[model samples]
Target: MHGLFRWSSKWWPGLIPFAILWVLAAWVSTVPLEAELAANSGTALKSTVLDKTQISVAGRDVSFAALAFSEEGRRSAVASVEAAPGVRLVNDGTRLVAEAKPFVWVAERDNVRVTLWGTAPLPASKARIVEAARAALNGTEVVDRMGLARGAPARFDAATLLLLDQVAKLKDGKIIVQDTAISLAGMARELGGREAIAAALKNLPEGFSVAANDVKAPPYVFQANKDPVAVTLTLSGYVPDNNVHAALVATAGRKFANEKIVDNLKASIGAPSGFSAAVTSALGALSRLSTGTLIVSDREVKLSGDALYEAAAGQIRAGLAKELPTGWTTKPEVSVKPAASPVDSTVCRQLFAQNLAKGRIRFETNSASINADSAGLLDRLIEIAMRCPTTAVEIVGHTDGDGDAGFNQILSEKRAQAVQDYLVKAGLPADRFSTTGYGSSQPIAGNETDEGKLQNRRIEFLVRQ
Candidate 1:
């Protein structure tokens, strides 16, 4: 028995090497099969929407796991691995991603920061959107509060990128994308920003449309500052178009002929109704002031300045609102300047001539009641009269040839008397003034044309030298 056991032990030691070789051969053979199975399964799922895909093989049994975009995609991924040439079975540890009904995304901005929240279709999509927001809002802080989801609309990334462009135009606001619809609400940073965004929406992808756009424009403001020290009328703010801009600049030249115009006005939309008329009238009031500021915001006009004299201040306050269009409002903060030093009758006559040449002292048709539109010019006349307090002045009134001579005579006399009474009421001495009427006899221009007729009616200040 001892001899037989010794012989068996020697044979067992010899067979150990063969056993090792057989195990090595089995392992080496299965490695290639497992690798081939994994490769084939992955290739099958290449066209599927899946995330965090993993495939493992142990003796040709496949373990497939992934987050799929849809239940069908998940089932197909498992089946693809099970059908692989060497795969015995698929473990099928796969799940559909969370679905968002009417998937929504939002980007909100306040004074300090812009925040992006809601669902992204994929991890790659999430990363791309956050990076895009940071790029667009360069200085502004951008926060990401987004997560992964399924059921995003088609062309989701393209639509989101386009909507982000509009966000750059807002001062502060929010933009929302729900499925294929987009909505925006906020205040625009610039005068025409609202329109620009609306125009841009036309280029959005075919499936998307604007559901609601409540973007409001900032105030439509037109401002003018009259600076006596600078001898400049600085016009700044908005105009409806280039034509109104040119007309305002020209009118400023005529009204403030002595002052240089510093035009800083920009052309934009959103001008109030009667914008040109309101601005023109406001500029006239501003011209009468030694220094003033005019602000027209929407339909409201706010004027602040020191008028040339006390009476002029009162007249501007009372007449400015009346000159505005219907539905327009005015707030005048007028004050009287310090009295100017007395001037000789020669200087006073020249001042009166300059004032009359700029504008006319108009009256109601056939009546001596002065038009409110003439208040600024009339105030200028009052200021010049105050400067020459000691001089006796003759106020002469004339008319065009359209009226009956007798009636024209009476009308002209009454007009002259009205001037004298207005000056007396403004604290000027009535004894230093005389009134006269020439009717249509002292015509400076022919009455054949309307332009000539306009020039024929005149009021002359003759300072007694």
Candidate 2:
């Protein structure tokens, strides 16, 4: 009895707490609980869109693919299988499954449960599904894989998928598409760059997104100026950086250069913001390449030697270090992409010289104030000049031979001067510009018809290196 008492005294401290805790737990579980006291399940998109599209917080379907999120925010997103609304209960719970169509899952926290019926549409449909779901239920958890809202379509959701793919590929600034026309809604470099993006997009089977910005002007055409990514290694005396630059050019230049531009920076310096990172990174990469040797080929950059094997590593670090600001360390991987949509000031100038080819802008009767609707295209041109600055140009204005020869000449000069004035006001060097008037002399189309005359009356810019 003495031994027992001693043992109990020594271990009783732990035993008492364990016994009390177990009993309390059991009691809590056994207590009657009201379902009304349970937490609420959030909301979801009740219906599917016949043609799957991006759904914004407003619940309206938009064509954009980008949807921003935060892990601790009001909502989150997931992918799942395709299950139409009011359909069978195939899979449920966190056993989340993914399909080309949609996902299926349930979300719960704080006794609150929200089952996302239309599993977020495949990556493609995600924008629309998430938008719709969030719009319908103010505070909702997004589950991937629930199916059709009552009135939504069950047909092809392919467009949504393609758009998602395009959006994903936007990192390199290349406009992505598989089929549909992807419009440019922002500024671009040379008109060639605009055309390059357009041409690349023209073959896409699925439609694409334009920048929501209003800088996109009409009369979209491609001149094919792919600016090659450039990295110049300044050789000290005669260590031969040519091989290195050559190799670097072979490796990255092809990616950036498409048509006429070998290096976007060299092509034109319109805005420092666009190429600032690229310039810094490229220069840093050039510095790193100084540490390695390259065997330059006609089209390939092959690295050799102990240092050569580490060329990519050296280049990435150097590029990232210089490109990113001090105190900011990069991931050691550098990726530079072209603009998604390019606005070619040079090309726009050309179009203006040619009267927007066919009604690109609506002008007032015999005036040069520019039409209100012409603002979009004009904005695009301004953007191009800002992006590509090395471009030297001549703004030539033309007129139809309807009025007196002298009057026509004066009108043509005023128009050319107007273009020149706008460019100069936008910070272009007046020295880089020269204007000429061809009063009804150089006509592409006939003067017999108003349409032909309109074509003849235009403002064009000849882009000189």
Candidate 3:
């Protein structure tokens, strides 16, 4: 028995390895079934153990990795387990795990709420947001937290009437907003009658309020008027208001007297007391901007200069009955002239050229982009080049020799072509313009000084003449 014990101890070391292999085979056979495991074993596989770590991928409780064998003798043992529907062979506890996600997150979760912010589509931005949310939900019942905001209801002013066709009433210093019923609650400056004050607020959106009037008034007659055709209004007194566009026309006509006549009429006003007349005159000045004159018609008025700006006249017209003043008894004389375009040099230089002078190329700092300040000047040059009939111009580009000659030559050539491209895009004849680069070879100015270097980095225009 002692000899037997010694022999068993000696053999235990060798037997322990086989025992571990057997245990591994048994454990592997119990793995979940999968198709990948089936390919490795003679039969389908059951499950996978990923890298012997917590990170893993498996088909339910069974994925294709159960057919792994620790020894040749155990191959059949693993195969038997792998023969199930979804099984494959693998090494002992060795596997791969996916490392990345492939989808984008639309919301925190399926039932999460969404709220959007931006310019609303005028009337239906709220409804549109709801509809978009419904589409995303795919018929699942979910609460909609989505809504719309229009940058904040714009600040109410005489100009606010132009944006909102409806206006609120300021009555007895109180705010009132009802359909077709409007009022104003402050001392009427230049206001000839109470009805005239109500008429101006008609163009405002359905809300009204009177802020404290702290603006001082002039002691002389002031006048202003608005022109829809030219989309411009003029001011002639100490009226603090500027840009008294079409929106303020009807009600404003009340504070000052406007001739029902088409002829240009003028007048001066008298002051009542304590600058009240001056204040009225200042507010009255805004009325002259209308199509007809708002003659002082004999009153103590004030005067001062007011500011002006371009405004949306259409919005103003929409606020009132164009032919009828909703709250006033005055008539706005309609003009037959068409609206005029605002004057600027952009269109002129694009289509017509008066002449070209001081045409020079301003280079980008160590680069090729034309400076912003130079765009207008360059536009003028292109315009003049267009006037030469049946002519082609060679646009030559040059560079100072600061870098590699070959590179500089290439850059210079590209710069010329860029100019040519711009001209053609600006409606010039592409066929009439040719680009060439001379690198540092053709320097019109010395390259030693910074100012002279700028002159060298230029485009020269030569006509066939």
For each candidate, C-alpha RMSD in Å?
A: 6.4, 27.7, 33.2
Q: Please, what are the lDDT tens digits per residue for candidate 1 over residues 227-318? A: 98998999999999999999999888767766789999999988878999999999989988988999999899999999988777886787
lDDT (CA) for every model shown?
0.87, 0.39, 0.40
Judged by TM-score relative to the true structure, which candidate is superior, 1 or 2?
1
* Model 1 worst lDDT window (10 residues): 371-380
**CA lDDT for candidate 1:** 0.87
lDDT of 3 by residue, 1-465 (tens): 999988887786787899999899767754543334434443222233112222122442222232112333235443444354443333333222221121111111122232222222122333443454456434544343322222223232233223111111111122222222233233223323234444444445554343322212223443444443553344444322232222233323333222221212223233333333332333333332234333222233212221121121221222222322222222223232222333333433433322222335555765667643344345445435544545667778889867788888988888888788767765677888788999888887788898887668777766643
Local accuracy of candidate 2 as per-residue lDDT tens digits, 55-103: 2221111112212222221122212111222222212222122232222
TM-scores for all candidates: the values are 0.70, 0.26, 0.27
Measured by lDDT, the strongest candidate is 1
Which model is ahead, 1 or 3, in terms of lDDT?
1
Q: Write the number of the candidate with greater lDDT, choosing between 1 and 2.
A: 1
- lDDT of predicted model 3: 0.40
